[model samples]
Structure formats: C-alpha cells, structure tokens
Target: MDHILVTGGAGFIGSNFVHFLVEHTDAKVTVVDKLTYAASRESIADLPADRVSLVVGDIADQPLMERLVAEHDAVVHYAAESHNDNSLADPSPFVHTNLIGTFSLLEAVRKAGTRLHHISTDEVYGDLELDDPERFTESTPYNPSSPYSSTKAGSDLLVRAWVRSFGVQATISNCSNNYGPWQHIEKFIPRQITNVIDGGRPKLYGAGQNVRDWIHADDHSSAVWTILTTGRIGETYLIGADGERNNLDVVRQILAHFGRPEDDFDHVTDRAGHDLRYAIDSTKLRTELGWSPRFGDFEKGLADTIEWYQAHEAWWRPHKDAVEASYAAKGQ
Candidate 1:
C-alpha cells in the first residue's frame, strides 16, 4: 500500500505502528484520532512531517470515515475505548467507540472497497486458568469478561460479519499485553514504573498472581504489518512473544531494576471480573508469515521500557499525579 489510514494512531500501539511504518515502508500515513485522554499528539510529533500527518476526528463519523477510507489504500482499525478500569466506571464510551465505531468503519471500508485490518485484544478470549496448559488461539471461544473486552469481542464479530456478508477485505489480530514507550501512565506497567520513578512503592492489585503474556509494542507493530501485507483475508492471527509473566514477578522485576526491595509494594483490591491469566499461542502467525518478536527476553524488554520512561519523564509527568489520585480515590 502506498498510502495508509490509521485510526487511533495517536494512542500507544497505533502510534508505535505508525512509527514502524515510517521506518519500514515507503507509505505515507494519515492518522485520524479523537485525541482522547489516553492519546497524545507528542507521541507522533517528532516523526517526519513529510511522511506522517494527523486528522482530528472520530471513527464513528461515517461521512468523515467514508472520505478518508476512499483516499487510503488500506485502513488499520485501532481506535477503541480500551481501559478496563475506565470501562467498568462507565461502559457508554466503550460501547459507542468499540462497537459503533467499528461498525461505522466496516461500512466505510465495504463501500470504498478498501482493505482493512482490525486490531483487537486477547482479552476477548477471557482469562485462562493460572495453570492451564493450553493458550489462546484462533479457534478459542469468545468469553470476554469485562465491558472493555466484551465490546472488543463485539467489534471483532462485526469485522467477521462484514467480511463474510459483504466481502470486505479485512484481517483481524488479537494481541497480548503490550508494554513500551508512550503508553499512558494509567496502564499497569507504566503506572508501576512511573510510581517507582516518583520514589513511591508500586501498588499491586490483590495477590498480584494474575498472569499476562507480554509483548513489546515494536514487535506487535511488526507482526501487524506482516499480517496486513501477507495474511489471508478473513484469517485471525494471534500475536505473542512467549513472554508470560505473572503480576507478582513483573513488579519484583521492576523493583529489582531500581535496587528496591521486591516486597515493598502494597496490595490493593483487584479489579472486578479480572481474568486470572492471558496467554497467546502465535504459532500460526510465525509459521505462516515468518514473523517473530525481537524482544524475546522479558527482563531485557522491561529494562528498556524503564529506560524509555526515565528518559521521557516530561512526556508522561504531567499526567502522573492525576492518574495516581484517580486510583487512590478508588482505593486501587
């Protein structure tokens, strides 16, 4: 594709993918974002202006999307109300953005005959048992737990329906937890890392035994690019890097890197309906697309993420206090 339109391109993963495209492809990228609290223009500010541009808008704006989709060779749908905590507090935005927004995008793509790639979360498969031998795959049943996940599940279904019924050229990828730079401080990893930077003990939810299969954003970006270019239409790919680490271990590793005691953190109430574990088996993606994650070492990737947060304090600092206060209000 010579030109691409990316929804939610100002947010964490989408912005990373935009950066990846600039470095890896000759395509010109136009990013449409609502500029929500979780997204930052600064994330994309330093990218080459000649190659990237931003349009302030919502994906649910049907007329706007129709115009934009008609211009780009392909669309990568990444816009969604993604925070589980926020979704729990209020599901209205989640439903509107994740479901209604996706429906709007699908319609636009169907009309424009544009190729599309839908981004989704592995949480749609719900949580696995802490000791389950099997991981989530393309065939895994949908068992979403939270409003955030349920709406994402709904959005994924919309893409499949559009593809089967309307012959819309689209592919879907449900990725595991992503950790890297430019992530909002409200997220788990960045929240803890920033707490440490502020000389405060990191807060843990419940026992901190919940496991998340982590993947670096760079790797996720590369895998998505691979799928968009080479994956089969109507195929669902699971993207992961075998980087499974439980919450306790993740916090300990963060404390270790900072020369603090591992058990210095406090335990907060766990999230309602929080899944116990999430693991992704990406064998099909690797075997079929010849794609693999570069950040195989979870510890090394964690360290690099810490370094990025430390170096870019100015980017995330303004929001740190408000995020912590919000969590404190909920006793989390």
Candidate 2:
C-alpha cells in the first residue's frame, strides 16, 4: 500500500504501529483520532511531517470515514474505548466507538472496495481458567464478560459479517495485552511503574493473581503489518509474544527492578468482573506469516519500559494526579 489510513494513531498501540510503518515501509500515513484523554499527540509528533499527518476526527462519523477511506489504499481500524474500568462505569462510549465506529468504517470500506484490517483484543474470548492448558486460538468462541470486551467482540463479528455478506476486503487480528512506551499511566504496567517512580508503593488489585498474556506494542505492530500485507482476507490472526505472568508476579518484578522490597505494595479492591487469565496461541501467525517477537524476554522488555517511564516523567506527570484520584475514589 502506498498510503494507509490509521484510526487512533495517537494511542499507545496505534502510535507504535504508525512508527513501525514509517520505519519499515514506504507508505504515507494519515491518522484520524478523536484525541481522547487516552491518546496523546506527543506520541506521534516527532514523525516526519511529510510522511505522516494527523486528522482530528472520530471513526463513527460516516461522512468523514467515507471521505478518508476513499483517499487511502488501506485502513487500519484501531480506535476504541478500551478500558475495562471505564466501560464498567459507563458503557455508552464503548458502544459508540467500538461498535458503531466499526460499523461506520465497515460501511465506508464496503462501498469503496478498500483493503482493511481490524484490530481487536483477546479479551473478546473471555478469560481462560488459570489451570487451563489451552490458549485462545483463532476459532475460540466469543465469551466476552465486560462491556468493553463485548463491544469489541461485536465489532469483530461485524467485520466478519461484512466480509461474508458484502465482500469487504478485510482481515482481523486479536492481540494480547500490550506494554511499551507512550502507554497511558491508567494502564496496569505503566500505573505501577509510574507509582514507584513517584516514591509511592505500587497498588495491587485484590491478591493480584490474575494472569495476562503480554506482548510488546512494537511486536504487535509488526504482527499487524504482516497480516495486513500478506495474510488472506477474511481470516483472523492472534498476536502474542508468549509473555505470561500473574499480577502478583508482575508487581513484585517491578518492585525488584526499583530495588524495593517485593512486599512493599498495597492491596486494593478488585475490578468488577475481572477475567482470570488470557493466553493466546499465535502459532498460525508465526508459521503462516513467519513473524517473531524481538522482545521475547519479558524481564528485559519490562526493564526497558520502566526506564522509559522514568525518563519521560514530563509527559506523564501532568495527568498523574487526576488518574490516581479517580482510582482512589473507586477504591481500586
């Protein structure tokens, strides 16, 4: 593709993908973002101006989507209200962005006959048992437990239906949890890393036994590009880096990296309907597309993430107090 349109390109994962595209490919990129609180322009501001441009808009705007979609070679749909806690508090924005926004994009792509790729989350398959040996695969049944994941599941189904019923040229990828630079402090890893940076004890939810399959955002970006360029249309790919650790283990590791006692943390109320575990079996992507993660070692990747947060305090400090206050009010 010569020119690609990316929605939510200012957010953590999307920005990472945009950077990957600029460095690894020759495509000119246009970013359409609503600039929600979760997104930051600074994340992508340093990219070459001629190669990358930003358009302040929402994916749910049909006319806007059509105009942008017609001008691009392909579309990477990444905009969504993705926080589980926020979805619990209010599901309306999730519905509008994840469900209706995807619908609007699908309609535009269907009409234009443009190639499209939809980014989704593995949480749409619900949580696997902590002891379950099986991991989520492309054929896993959708059993979403929260408003955030359910809407994402609905959006994934929408893409599938459009492909089958209207012949929209599209592919889908559901990635595991992502952690890297430029992620908002509201996320789990960045929250703990920033808390420790501020000389405060990291807070854990409940006993912190929940397990998540983690992948670096950079790896996720590479995997998405592989699927976007090489994979068959109407197929779904699962992207992961085989990083699995429980919340307790992750917090302790963060403390260890800071030279603090492993037990030096507070336990808070758990989130409502939190899933137990999420593991992805990405054999298809690896074997079919020959993709591999450069950050295969979680400890090294995490240490790099910690260092990034430490060095980028100015970018995160302005919003730290408000995020902490919101969490405190919710007792989590």
Candidate 3:
C-alpha cells in the first residue's frame, strides 16, 4: 500500500511501527490519534513530515473514520483502551474504544475496500497455568480475564465476522508483551526502569509469579509490516519472540542493573483477576511468513530499553508522579 492510516500512531507500538515503516518502506503514513494520556506526540515528533502526518480525531467517530479510510490504501488498527488495571477500575472506555472503535473502522474499511490489519494482545486468551506447557496459538479459545482483554476479544471477533460476512480485506495479529523505546511509564518494564532512574525501589505485586512473553517493539513492528504486506487476507498471525520471564525475576533483574539488592523492592497488593501468565508460540508466523525476531536475548533487550529510559528522562519524568499516584490509589 502506498498510503497507510495508522490508528493510535502517537502511542507506543503504533509510533514504533510508523518509524519502522519510514526506515524500511516507501509508503506514506497518516496517523489518526486522539492523544490520550498514554499517547505522546514526542513519540513520533521527529518523523519526516512528507511521509508522516498526524490527524487528531477519535477512531469511534464514524464520519472521521470513513473520510480517513477512503483516503488510505490500508488501515492499521492499533488504538485501544489497553491497561488491565484501568479497565478493572472503569470498563466503559475499554468497551467504547476496543469494541466500538474497532466496529467503526471495520465499517469504514468495508465500504472503502481498504486493506486492514488489526493489532491485538494475547491477553484475550487469558492466562495459561504457569506450568501449563502449552502456549497461546491462533486457535486458542477466548477466555479473557479482564475488561481490557474481553473487549479486545470482542473486537477480534468483530473483525472475523466482518471478513466472513462482508469480505473485508483484513488480517489480525495478537502480539506478546512489548518493551522498547517510547513506551509509557504506565507499562511494567518502563515503570520499573523509570522508578530505578529516580532512585526509588521497584514495586512487585503479590509474589510476582506472573509471566509475560516479551518482544521488542521494533520486532513487533517488523512482524506487523510483514503480515500487512505478505499475510493472507482473513488470517490471524501470532507475533512473539519467545521471551518469557516472571514478574519477580524481571524486577530483580531491574534492581541488579541499578546496583540495588534483589530484595530491595516493595511488595504491593496484586490486582483482582490478574492472569498468572501469558506466553505466545509464534511458530505459525515464523513458518508461514519466514519472520524471525532480532531481539533473541531478553536480557540484552531489557538493558537497551532501560538505557533508553535513562537517556530520555525528559520524555518520562513529567508523567511519573501522576502515574505513581494513579497506581497508589489502586493499592498496587
């Protein structure tokens, strides 16, 4: 596609994907974002103007959706209410953004005959028992545990229905936990990294046994571009780097990097309905698309991410207090 519309392009993964597109392809990108608290213009502030332009608007606005979809050759849907804790606190935004926002894009793309790729998270499959041995693949049954994931599940089903009923040319990818540059401080890795940078102890929740399959955002971006360009329409691809580490282990590693004791961090209350683990098996994506992740070593990737936050304190410092306050109120 020569012209692409990337929803949530001001946010973490979307902005990273936009940067990936600029370095790897010739396509022009149009970003549709509402600039939510989790989004930052600085995330994509320096991208070339001729190839990338930002349009401030809500994805749920159907009129805006149609106008933007018609102008682009493809749409990459990444906007969503994605935080589990926040979703548990108030599910209304998740329902509106993850469900209704996806519906709005599907309708617009269906009418415009635009190629579409939807970005989703593996949390929709819920948690696997820590020792379950089986990882989430494309055919995993939907067993979402939180409002955030359930709404994402609803959105994924909506895309499938549209493809079957209306022949909308679209593909979907559910990725593992992403950690890299420009990630908001609200996320786990960045939160811990920034906390250490500020001389604060890392916070661990309940015994910190929860596991996340980590993938660098750059890798996630490459895989999405692969699927958008080479993937079969109406098919779903799983994106992962096979990087799995538990929360306790991850926090200890972060503390070690900052010359703090492994047991220096505080243990806070875990959220209700927190899934125990998430792991993604990306064999299908690797076999079908010949895609491989470059960040094969989790520790190395984590170090690079920590370094990014350390060097860019200006990017995260302004938001740290508010984020910590929000978490404190939740008792987590």
For model 3, what is the alpha-carbon lDDT of residue 145?
A: 90
Candidate 3 ranges beyond 4 A from true positions: none
Better of 1 and 3 by TM-score: 1
lDDT tens per residue, model 2, 185-273: 99999999999999999999999999999999999999999999999999999999999999999999999999999999999999999
For residues 190-293, could you state the per-residue lDDT of candidate 1 as single tens digits? 99999999999999999999999999999999999999999999999999999999999999999999999999899998988889999999999999999999
For all predicted structures, in order, the TM-scores are 0.99, 0.99, 0.99
Separately for all candidates shown, the number of backbone clashes (residues 3 or more apart, or on different chains) is 0, 0, 0
Cα RMSDs of all predictions? 0.5, 0.6, 0.7
Give each model's whole-structure lDDT.
Answer: 0.97, 0.97, 0.95
Q: Write the per-residue lDDT of candidate 3 for residues 4-70, one digit (tens) a residue.
A: 9999999999999999999999999999999999999998889999999999999999999999999
The predicted structure with the larger lDDT, 2 or 3, is 2
Candidate 3: global Cα-lDDT?
0.95
- Runs in model 1 deviating more than 4 A are none
